[model samples]
Target: MNKLFAFFLAMLLPVVLFAQTPKMGEFTQNEIDLKEISYEPGASAVFLVASGESRFFSNILETNYFYRIKILTEAGKEYADIPIGYFAGSTNVEVVSAIKAQITTYTNGVPEVTTLGKESIFQVDLGNGYKEFRISFPNAQVGSILEFSFKKADKNIEFLDGWSFQRSVPVLFSNYQITMIPQLEYKMIGQGENFYHRSEKSEGNGVYSWTLRDLYSLKGEPYMKNYQDYVDKVEFQLSRYQTAATTSGPEWTDHLNTWEKLGDELIEYYSVRGFYRTNPLEREVLSLDLSKGSQKDKAEIAYYYIRDNFINEGEDLIYTKQTLPQLLKSKKGAPGELMLAYMGILKSQGIECNPVLIGSKGHGRSDIVPFPFLNQFDEILLLVKLDGNLQFLDLSDPLAPFGYVDLDKHVKGGLFLEKNASKLIPIDIRHNSNKLVFSNIKLDTETGDLVIENTIRNYFYEGLASAHLVEILEKNDKPLEELFSEKYDALEIRNVKVDDLLEDKNMYNISFESVLKNAMSEDLIIFNPLQISKFATNPFTQEFRVFPVDFEYAFNETYTANLVIPEGYELDDYPTNESITIPGSPIGFSYSTENLGEIFKITARLEVKNPLIPSSSYGDLKFFMESVSSKLTAPVILKRISIP
Candidate 1:
């Protein structure tokens, strides 16, 4: 029996040592094994194994990530090259190893491996305090295996590390292990509803691990905001710290324990008081005669002065390198810096104003959490107390008026940093956010054509949308009239007149004259009076939505078409009207027509009373948009009673 056991031990000793060997930062042969992978159905590539290990040693924390992917189809070739980004200020990322192997039937299914050298790796410096390390695997093709490992080390103890198990492609197995020294305390914030498989006991040693398997690819839908908001991920924030000699470390201050604390920290960081150290725009503010008018009126003059003179460069929540003097002279600054300048100018005029930090529409809403973090907010606006009433100003938006805050800036809540104390306050702006379009059409029996005059009035958010649309058209070098004609081939715009296009006002009006060709056919005249319909098809095409559909603000759009029927033609049939209303949701769509003798009137209204619709009511919103689309497609058929 002893001789038989000795023989088995000798055979397995080599395999056990190789498996248990410490390859913490190396790409091993097993990782690049190109054996057949039972990939998930419809998956272009599969992550055979993905693991991340984070260890805190001495003063620096190092995170090593390893990934092995098997390419199954042509679409998976994109996975052969990947870019990894890290904050350049604190972290240094290094590619430890990368290897690629291809298995073929040649020589009885032998595998040929190729190691990626340092020449295949490139480091790119992306402005805005970030850098990316791009790595490409050589000789990677279908049925090939690619494996790479990278390590990022940082001495900063901010505890901002986050891990995401899901990606654009399916992951077969993902495991993350974190080991920390008992000195650091962190708050684990998790998103998504997936639970990780973890060990029973590891808290005593300051070690934790999570494993996830068979995670499907994250599907993107229309109108979706930042993908990070919905991805299944876990993040850690350093709340406080402890040490061996002292119970709590000196660097572990409760600076962000409350919203007020967070506000105070930001005020100190941005030097809010320093912004008003000098009154650079005093001459301009004095010439406006703001003292005689109400505070609201005074704010309008100041808002327009900033909006017209300077251009916002789209950066948010941070100050620009240029000073106020430089910014005012150059007429250009980032959005946050512009708002800060506005506040400084307003404060010099004895106006009560404070800065408010909130997330913008494109940035998505802040997470509902107890603690306060600067990353939670994106944009900065001002809060003005006028005549004992609170007013918000989004001076960054050129078209937005003083009283009319940009709907995107209304993040429901903001940290209002006041003089003595700070608090979390709700942002509510009183402005009409609607759009009205009235079209009058007259059919010419002699020319077989129709002349339609469209009058469009946009208010608040609606005006912003109109301004953005025109800006995009101009940026792309496309004429507004030409784009309109292209969108509807039958319609040709003759003239267009716009109002308040160059002003900061609540409403803007546009009127245009267009002609529709072939309105009068040989025997029948077919025309779609609602030719200016914005929606051709439902925007919500996803079968299931896991995230809420955020419209940012409530808006109402009304379209009225007054058509004069051509002589000797009677209406054979009109499109059936549609009215859809969900009991709980605030979205509504209605279509109706009224026959007023010679002038046949058709009115369609799409009113969204609620700015946001939860995923639970996605079906209702989809159905409403679908109904409007169908009604817009069906034309009004006219039959000729007698040929003149």
Candidate 2:
């Protein structure tokens, strides 16, 4: 892919000039005296001007970057240190020029400039073939203006990092200009919520420029998936190029424009098909007894056999680093390699399975564009047909149950690699993460105390998370009571019993006894019936959200409590029965109460049917969560009755 991108960039090289490029070290009065950005008033720092100019010359692509920032507050002083990074291991890319930085401060309207000296510049190796050039601006302070400029040259033109108009700090003006030849055709993809100005000049060479002004800083919100998915940015992909033709018509070459061709190339270059054909695990597969059970049962045996036998090195890579035989001999490999071995075993037993390439949750959205960009995917899962049903399996997590896909890998779709049938397939898992709680409470009139017995059941992903937490706590020699106490405030817990935690089951159970002190106050008793509250406080604190809220997966939390009212007190006030649902969505919440003679039963369930909620529905979701929190934490009041 890198070579192909480099070739396309080489074809775009021509003598071109950009007149709109900003000159370094120039600052306007408004930028110098800027106190805060009008759009983003709370921003500590603001980018006054950010510009980039790129051109291919002499078989090398050189990009010049200029940035001017104003530090409005003390926290903004951290911007004084800037680190420019590049892949040092790649000979094709390098920092060809020295970095220049200066800090400008005003004293009674008089501008004073301090230039960065060579002593303040240093280099650091960031491991994994990466290195960073650190530049420390001299005498940086609040209300100071910092300016920096550097040139980066890449022999591999595919290293075009494109441009991001918006950042964590507000950007007043962000511009990027690229010079290209007419022979090559490139596809430009722009994303985010911003209007941009685009212009093209053709003076024997093509000069394309993009300019975005006054872009607000994209702030991170609760439950946001990936910042890159919503940040204002532009990317370019080489689509087609014209070749010197010897025949009657000119020839145009397609550069990975189709998913099918990209899949074919991946198989060919990575030797994926070769590994399948060679059956690297044939000997191991033959040793396993497979003729005893049904296809699904056999698949389970094969999955567990590979999962239990092989050690995962904890890397979520798509390709295998070692050969199958080498991995088998070592008994340890990356998740992808082990999955491949599992696939080999399944294939040997005539089971239907294929590798699915996916971009995990933190990797950003997979369907950003229709273009076949291979870099979009960072991990691979197995798509198998068992009992005529499709299931996605990720062996990355050792404790994850069979047919369990990691929550991070629960993307909208994945590229199913099945020879000629390779295509994008939806990832629909029927399982949900749920937590069920049943609490029995008794109020003591004399001592003003409440005794509670709670039983909690966690299913699917929730159970896996609980199991991991249990493992960690047990490793540290901490009692399970600590977990319960930390979770429920103002409660004393005892007699904790955990079941099916380390076992390979879909659900885990935890039962414990707790006492809530001071339930009665003078003539009244106030208590919260819920033993396990999902939301103690509203997660959606921000009034407005620019990005979608990703809950990771659909979840359900049900809390059922039976409170035995004391003989001296009668129920006076309780949370009213109410049901609320987001219109046109599956998200809902309900709280109901029942009076059964002396026993008061409270049932509440919070169901989020859709994990990903769009920003447009954020207000409703926020309101719903606020209501749920209020109802769950609302105290049940009981007034003392005079002796009759």
TM-score to native of every candidate shown: 0.82, 0.90
Quality of model 2 by C-alpha lDDT: 0.76
TM-score of 2: 0.90
lDDT of 1 by residue, 216-320 (tens): 666666665644555566677777553223456333333235676677777775563355533435564334455668777777787887787778785676545
True-structure RMSD, every candidate: 8.8, 3.5
Question: Each candidate: what lDDT?
Answer: 0.67, 0.76
What tens-digit string does per-residue lDDT give for candidate 2 at 1-644?
Answer: 45654564456456655465565557777776689777666788988898888876746667888899889888888998888888757553565475888888898988898888888888888887788889888778888888888888776443256787777788888888788765666777766656333322233347777778887677778888575666666677777765554578656777654777777766664454334644324565345677768778988887777778888887788877876557656778888788877776676667788888888876744353667778778888888888897777778888776888777787778788866667888887777579999999897667777878899899988888888888889999999888777657777888988897533668889899887778665677666767367585788987667678877788999999998878777999998999998877768889999999999999999888877788789888889889988988888887889642
The window of 10 residues in a row where model 2 has the poorest summed lDDT is: 195-204
Choose the strongest candidate by TM-score.
2
